[model samples]
Target: MAETDPKSVQDLTNVVQTLLQQMQDKFQTMSDQIIGRNILTEHSLNNDNAVLKRLKEHQKNPKRVKVHREVYLKRNMKSFTLKRFPQ
Candidate 1:
């Protein structure tokens, strides 16, 4: 059997180590990106849930109603003019 040179064997070992390190670094970066996306999605879901809850609570109450100020002013002005003219 032909014996392998010590220098060639050492070079092969170094190449394999470098490749492994590169793979590990890529895997860590992918994992961190996925985790960051998951965290952002979770926060978005939480905000949506809070907004829905507040809307539901607002719907359940009869007195806590919203009216546009412009519409209210127009309506009052009409009523005032009608009362003043009496027609």
Candidate 2:
């Protein structure tokens, strides 16, 4: 086997260091983006859960207008009478 030159070995080491640093930086950027998206997704899921809870509560106790036919007739008559009188 041939002996390697010291200068060439140093140059090779420097190139490998530079490539490793670039890969580390790229990995850090990707990790930060993934973490950010996860946080946003978690926040959105929480909001959706809150809205679903409110909807379920509303369904459990819904506002219902129970009007008897006689009451409705009386109200209708009164309105008709007022409209006829124009006062």
Candidate 3:
């Protein structure tokens, strides 16, 4: 059995970290392009639907909707709203 030197181990760790960062950047770029293309296509399609077009336009230029009454939340409580935005 051979013992690994500390410098060699550190170099290997650095290489692995660099490779991981490169992979993450590539994946993020690809995902962004895909999402952008989908949004453009969807907006083009919804141009014909008057109601959908109106909603999209509103989202593009968001106006404040009426604010509802405030509700109290308990400590350590997590809340989330699931909304499907028109593409």
The C-alpha lDDT values of all candidates are 0.83, 0.81, 0.65
Model 2 per-residue lDDT tens digits across residues 30-87 = 9999999999999999999998987787676655223344677899999999999977
Candidate 2 wrongly placed segments (more than 4 Å): 1-7, 64-87
Kindly indicate the candidate among 1 and 2 with the higher lDDT: 1
Worst 10 residues of 2 by lDDT: 61-70
Q: Between candidates 2 and 3, which one is better according to lDDT?
A: 2
Q: Model 3, range 1-87, lDDT digits (tens) per residue?
A: 134333687877987888899999999999999999999989977775877766676676554221111232322122432233333
Measured over all alpha carbons after superposition, the RMSD of each candidate to the real structure, in angstroms, is 12.8, 14.1, 14.6
Candidate 2 total steric clashes: 0
TM-score, one value per model: 0.63, 0.60, 0.47
Candidate 1 residue lDDT tens string, 20-84: 99999999999999999999999999999998997787688745635444667889999999999
Return the lDDT, model 2, position 75: 97
Over all chains combined, what TM-score does candidate 3 have?
Answer: 0.47
Model 2 scores a TM of: 0.60
| Candidate 3 Cα outliers beyond 4 Å, as residue runs | 1-7, 48-87
Best-to-worst TM-score order: 1, 2, 3
